[model samples]
Target chain A: MARWEPDAQARLQNAALELVARQGFERTTAAEIAEAVGLNRRTFFRHFPDKRDVFFAGQDQIEADLVAGVTGAPPGESPMGLVGLALARAADTFAHLPREQARARQAIIDAEPALLERERQKFAVLARSVGDAMRERGVADLEATLAAESGVLVFKTAFTQWLADGESRSLPLIIAETMAALRALYVTR
Target chain B: MARWEPDAQARLQNAALELVARQGFERTTAAEIAEAVGLNRRTFFRHFPDKRDVFFAGQDQIEADLVAGVTGAPPGESPMGLVGLALARAADTFAHLPREQARARQAIIDAEPALLERERQKFAVLARSVGDAMRERGVADLEATLAAESGVLVFKTAFTQWLADGESRSLPLIIAETMAALRALYVTR
Candidate 1:
């Protein structure tokens, strides 16, 4: 086997998801996933600590993007404005992923309570990180937490809509629309 | 021992928390917890399915209270208004719990990742139930979800405040103040 495999991480993630979706998460093995991608089990273990980690492959990158979005916002923007920019940026990460692949991933997560728990934990961490970023930019503590959580709520709502059957809008567009709807809720009456 | 012991559930819960806080959640056993409160392992199992459940003893009642608060709102209340009422009612449940006990429970939850994951899952369930109750009250689908999520965020924020060392406000007051802060985020400028 070649010592250097290009895009090995991506290949392993794709293979893991495909195998898990077909055979179920518990039934799938790391070795089988590696073999399907023409890599050894060692290579799979090197890329991911466990099979479940493969299911959440790009979460760190997504979190970094969100934090950068908040930190880089123009001075004088409201806390919610910073959150809006951050979530829109994070939505772009989803834009690069194939909707069918994302849907399949969601299906696997939905079927497994353990995976769903991990997903919830991931969002909790994301909210905390985004809130910290907002605080670094001088937003008040309570406001930062509220904005970060609200941003996550918008992302979740828009992600669901983006994955809906026959929906044609881009993820970023859906995120923007969701943010607008959230604002509308508070402003009306 | 008598098969029916009065307040066995609450006794077991208090004993479990004390044991777990002293010995750590991983080191504590259901039998040990039951023994601390003058009960047997069999009696503990009857009250809770697992030892971890003791920390979350009254969650079902809390969920029911939140849902009822949403469903029982006066006619023509807005979605956010309904959420505000629901969370404030949920706050009352926390008010009945002694501050030190709630603080200890939170410490244990914060120390254990498994417990924290379960807590997040509980909140997720609470949010969904709150949203469903809003839907039954004629709120639109997206608005209902958004409002429910926002309510949970307010609850979490107020909860942390209520637990803070120097803060003495009631949970319901903190929840209402948090809801007002959430609204202020959108209404200002």
Candidate 2:
């Protein structure tokens, strides 16, 4: 792999997002994305299996980090606590992206039904991964699944609020607050 | 539509499931589904736009029923209570299907990535609808969203446990118990 492979992949993704935003996802081509990044189609294909995958390129790494986070957490913590920490760490992975790029990508996903389906599947996969990681910690089946799924809900709700127009909270802060709020819901009754 | 329209649609769906289970989803054609049901191709198209829709045809009605349940609940009910009741009512919509048919359809979906993606999207949509219905009842946004999402987790968890081998608990009982369990998770901490 080239020393600059990561940068090249990011560039290809950014270019693809720009092209997909200008023209609909259906009209965008892999060659065009590569050309915009000053790379060849073969180079693009090396980084991404297809144009659709370019947007979801970091999913594998993110999923691994989430699972590792849960599995590596101190064993004394509760299941939901472990899941929460794992998802918070995963949120940290996205701190590197510029807001404009994030918004641009989200726009394309919001506009395309196919991309929305892919996004939902990504979240589902993350929930399953977190559940399995919980089981690896000796948690029971139902508890692990429920805690993992609830953690995912917190992650999604926080991400939505963090990205909303004019909202300025950091992802971790938002996630923590959302988790507290979710817990508080049951307490008030 | 004719008096037999509902019966025809149900037959087509049953036939589609049988064929999809036998030869796989990609290999099963619309004509074959119609032939299995002893119906014409035109009748198939009238009910479902494509082969994929045959499996998802009930989603529209189910979603509508869920939303209505939330909206029409007693004003004094908690958001989670309303959501739980709504989901239970929706389960009744599927109570008429034979257990074997439900198992066969679920097995196909579990084995196919595409069908799994569709299922996740369906769950997401239901969560959104329940949340919106909560909003309509004067509930705050974040609370409504969280409650709806948590309710979906309960619904899913109950459905999984209910459908497991040798399990025969009624859907309402299972849903009620799952919601209690979820709330209990927050209490003991």
Which candidate comes out best when scored by lDDT?
Answer: 1
Q: What tens-digit string does per-residue lDDT give for candidate 1 at A38-142?
A: 998998889888777888877888799899899888999999889878987888777777988888888889999878988898889999999999998889999
For the second chain, the TM-scores of the candidates in order are: 0.94, 0.89
Q: What lDDT would candidate 2 get against the real structure? A: 0.82
Residues B1-189 of candidate 2 have per-residue lDDT tens digits of: 354765888889889898998999889889889887678888789988766778887788778878878987888787767777788777787666466667788888888887888778888898899899899888889989999898778877887887788878776677777777777777666
Find the 10 residues in a row with the least total lDDT in model 2 chain A: A1-10
DockQ of each: 0.78, 0.64
Docking tier of model 2: it is medium
Q: What residue runs in model 2 are displaced by over 4 Å at the alpha carbon?
A: A1-6, B1-4, B92-97
